[model samples]
Target: MSETKQSGSPELQWVRILDLDELPEGRVQTVTAGTTSLAITHYQGKYTALDNRCPHQGGPLGEGSIENGWLRCPWHGWDFCPHTGKPPGGYDDGVPTFPVETREDGIYVGLEAKPPRIRTVSDVMVETMTQWGVTHVFGMVGHSNLGFADAMREAERAGKLTFIGIRHEGAAAFAASAYAKLTGRPAACFAIAGPGATNLLTGLWDAKVDRAPILALTGQVDTQVLGPGAFQEVDLATAFNGVAEWSQTVLPSSRHAELMSLALKNAMIKRDVAHLILPNEVQEMPAEGKPATTPEGRVTPMEITPPAASVEAMLKLLRTSKRPVIVVGHGARFHMAPIVQLAEQLNAPVVTTFKAKGQISDHHPLGCGVLGRSGTPIASWFMNESDLLLVFGASFSNHTGITPKKPIIQVDYDAMALGKFHKVAVPVWGEIGITANLIRNELGAIDTVDQRPEVRARWAIWREEKLRREKDDRGRGINSASVFAAMNRVIPENAVIAVDVGNNTYSFGRYFECTRQSVLMSGYLGSIGFGYPAAIGAHCAAPDRPTICVSGDGGFGQYLGELTTAVKYGMNITHVLLNNNELGKISKEQRADELEVWQTSLHNPSFARYAENCGALGVEVTEKARLDECLERALAHEGPALVEVRADALLV
Candidate 1:
């Protein structure tokens, strides 16, 4: 294959590939014209193409997929667009983009030379991204990304876009995910080759499960020395395959626009991950084309409508049933007003999963509080006693649904999730928002009954019983309730709380209340080390907001290195270490099985000392009396801070 540079010509040129009908939705195919390899993707009634190699490490871009408008590399999960070759969310470097047009018979990609003096790949990428309305890029600096990082710095100085430096590569990915989720737009992150790419996998997995649109860029070894065991060489494509929706390696400079465009399209449209593997050597290589335009920021319209059969069936059941209960989950979080209205109309008590707490307040007249393993006993008792369960926006997993055999009217966005675990008598398929509206509209059609007075009386008794039970259990060491109450008092209402998994998550669930929807957790992945990185991401996502991370001693240590990232970025996030000094859950399980808890016992460093070593504020609280003062000091500090609270492992 020979490389072609742009000549001073205004005419457009093209390379023809497959027929329009040959492309399939949600899948990609590879095509080669002479020496240039191209990836073609068909998605949401559009077609796009990009180069076959990842810029980071020459990972095959032909294997990537297109969702929305972003093309996701199957290798390391980097994202770029096939139309403009720009990375989504204001990335500096762009992949090569070809002009794609579909005729009655076939699809054609233009091979026009971009303008001269494009300067650097990052400049071209930035120009392309600006066209897409992406204003921010989240990344960490390392040896492999020196040139691109320099370009990003220049871009930031020029006010072309904003670049937020993160301490760790993983933190960068997590921050990008949070930003994308909150804004409903694509976000980008970059990292050096080898270790940096490996470190980012944890955050990438979370994004994949949560369905966030993220573009991950990774530096790669020189393409010339690939697979010959060059320095810092590793198969990044294989490393990221499990988590990314698509992955690709950028090839030689001649094909930059094509590959980059593919990646962006995948990340944006699919609301999934796209990995772009860029070779260290090719980043400075010259390419020519007309200045690429940024994609217009367009909101994806919600198309879900309520199923008539399911809605009618559920309404009939609700009207006839005497003892009905409503169980809300994370799905209901976005439909708070309608959910509350529905609860009021039915005159029924409401219980939420831990993730869905605050969907209704604890003080609501018929609120039963959270319903789960760690939920209020009264809530659980009511769920068990109810004849029909009106499940909304929740999967009714084993963790949330203890009474699966009971008759359930499930409302969900995905119909397949309905009746998968529980006995769902009616399955309503619709967006939670729309379904809530439909239910509200139908409320007036049903016969009216003044059941609120009776329901309120029963709830009062239940609430008192729950308070008594919690009071009796207060003496238990490491009781989650005491920790929650203390935390509730100390943590400010404007704070952003990030919780890790394990018994610590369950414990935190007992007392963590959010006045607003600022709480973040790994509900889908349930990964142990998510808290620390997630906190870093949350802090980066909302710099003005006070962020707090609560993690078990075990979960905290898993991503302890992220503290250094926090320090480096000067993020103001308070990290609360629940120092049980052991893998409490595993230890408890082992003891129950009559096995010795050997490796579960961890020798932890003094957390305060570790935080101090990382150049962050540190405090230790052994007694409950010192907690308030310790937390106040930590929050008052300017940068990242850590507060380690020592507790008995047996309580978990």
Candidate 2:
């Protein structure tokens, strides 16, 4: 490590090292100044520096990985700001960050004290956020959180952070969720008490399900009026218990930075949302101590230790079973090499859950596509015939593999997920340990049952046959199959696809063949309105790649306001609305259940017109002949665009 800056000013004295070109993208390099160490990262042609230690347990920051603008500590995946050394959400204390100056020859870091002012609680709140790397806040304003909302406005004007207002609390939560997922950090959201908190539940659940970090701040009644059945005074602590990883009520006139710090640390450490119930009185409180700075040092990486006996048992079982099958999930995604090696070692067919669709390419000889109700017939057949099943890194949700009479070996990071929905004969927990054990230990080789060679060949033939059939399945008029094929042709190979829940989702699953895996869906949650915001998130995550959202008219209407968010961020996602003039899935389900389908039918708006109103390029395709042109136009547009494809009311 080298130092460059030499100054006598205690606040401004710092040092510089390596030229800007030396820092690699998505990787952080450590530099030292006196006894202080810092992690420096370069993103989108900008250099940012933070104390090398995490405030939560002093994890090493240099070891953390950089994705988007957030730096995730490698040890426990705690996210922090490389710009101001502030943790996501609000933290009581932030890392000590120095001013960064870049020149043609080298980069310099300077330590400087901020000018003091008579700051309000809201002022401190915004100031704390400036230390963190967040540039925007996605939320809905209400009476309870009005002060915080006003503070956000001030922050926006001061060039500290931007505030994006949403239509509903649910939408705000969902938008924040998407933002966090895209940026790989905890995005903040504000909601009022009572109904506001309740409305945010669904989106919060979605975030928890997807493992996205978010910060939810809701206003509460003053502490002095507690248990008095005061208006809007619900037990916020109990109300948000199950919805968030950590929830707490801020006391009246309490130290704002300290409480905010606690919330941020909890969210970062737990890798989940931290809900802070701020009382009206607390929003105007004054600070007591000098605001804390970001910590310094390297984060320790997590290690998974394997159980020796369990590994040996699993290998022995794999060797004994002639027709074994491996089901890969998201856990397998993190260790792609190990998974590929295991698949090759056993010569077993590999099938993925919907979320893990492209863990291994479908073109691989032993690779089978998704396995579920929407999976390919060949994958279903493989599952039905397998003698031993090895499932990795995914919960055996009800929507996944239904059930197999054969023995199951489940490998996952969460023990609760094991044997929750299905029975598991051998369950191994932890990512690295299970994988390492399998690789190191070799059991006896069992005789290969070559009886299914012809069967396997037939399945391969069938896969190709299905693709051809899909291509030729376009009917006389506009239909789901034709729309999918058109979309497949128009979307770039690297595009990320977000499919909304409904009958349209089923059609998308059947028709869309993702060339490379960047597709996202609600998966087990099956939540409505997931498509649009998720597409925005995907675009944020990989701005270089285009993102397309396929949704039904009903699903699109739920979060249509997100168009403003896309425009604000200058994202270039293409929104495709499958206009069928009805809730297609619910209509089918009602008919099946012999119930009256009253509200299932919908009179949808002209999505093209709606998109235009939101300041994005819009196109309407009522006929199949115009789809290719419309899709092309929508995709080529500079910013967000919408393409509405009108189709029949029913799929049959």
lDDT of each: 0.73, 0.72
lDDT of 1 by residue, 1-652 (tens): 2122243335756667987677777777888865468777676677766666777866676787766767778888888775555678787656664557787778876665445534567556655654565566777777777666766676778787777776667777776776665555677888989988887887777777766778888899878888988878889999988878889887664455545566777777676898888788666665455355444444356658876887788778877766677898865666777877877777667888876766676657767777887566657877776777888877566677547667888888766767776466888888777887787787565544444565566556754653453353333244544466567777877677888887777766654544553667776667787788778767756778899898988888877887887888788989888887788888877888999877987889999999999999999876666777888899899999998887666554
Evaluate model 1: give its TM-score.
0.73
By lDDT, the best candidate is 1
After aligning candidate 2 to the native by TM-score, how far in Å is the CA of 394 from where it should be? 1.7
- Candidates in order, TM-scores: namely 0.73, 0.72
| Candidate 1 deviant stretches above 4 angstroms | 1-118, 126-138, 159-164, 178-186, 252-265, 287-289, 293-300, 445-479
- Give the CA lDDT, 0 to 100, for residue 291 in model 2: 71
Clashes of each: 75, 16
lDDT of 2 by residue, 123-228 (tens): 6665665555556566778877877777787778888776766667777777677666555467777788878877777777877776667788888766787787
**Model 1 weakest 10-residue run by lDDT:** 1-10
How far in Å is the alpha carbon of 69 misplaced in model 2?
58
Regions of candidate 2 where Cα sits further than 4 Å from its true position: 1-136, 146-163, 179-185, 224-233, 252-271, 293-300, 331-333, 432-477, 594-597
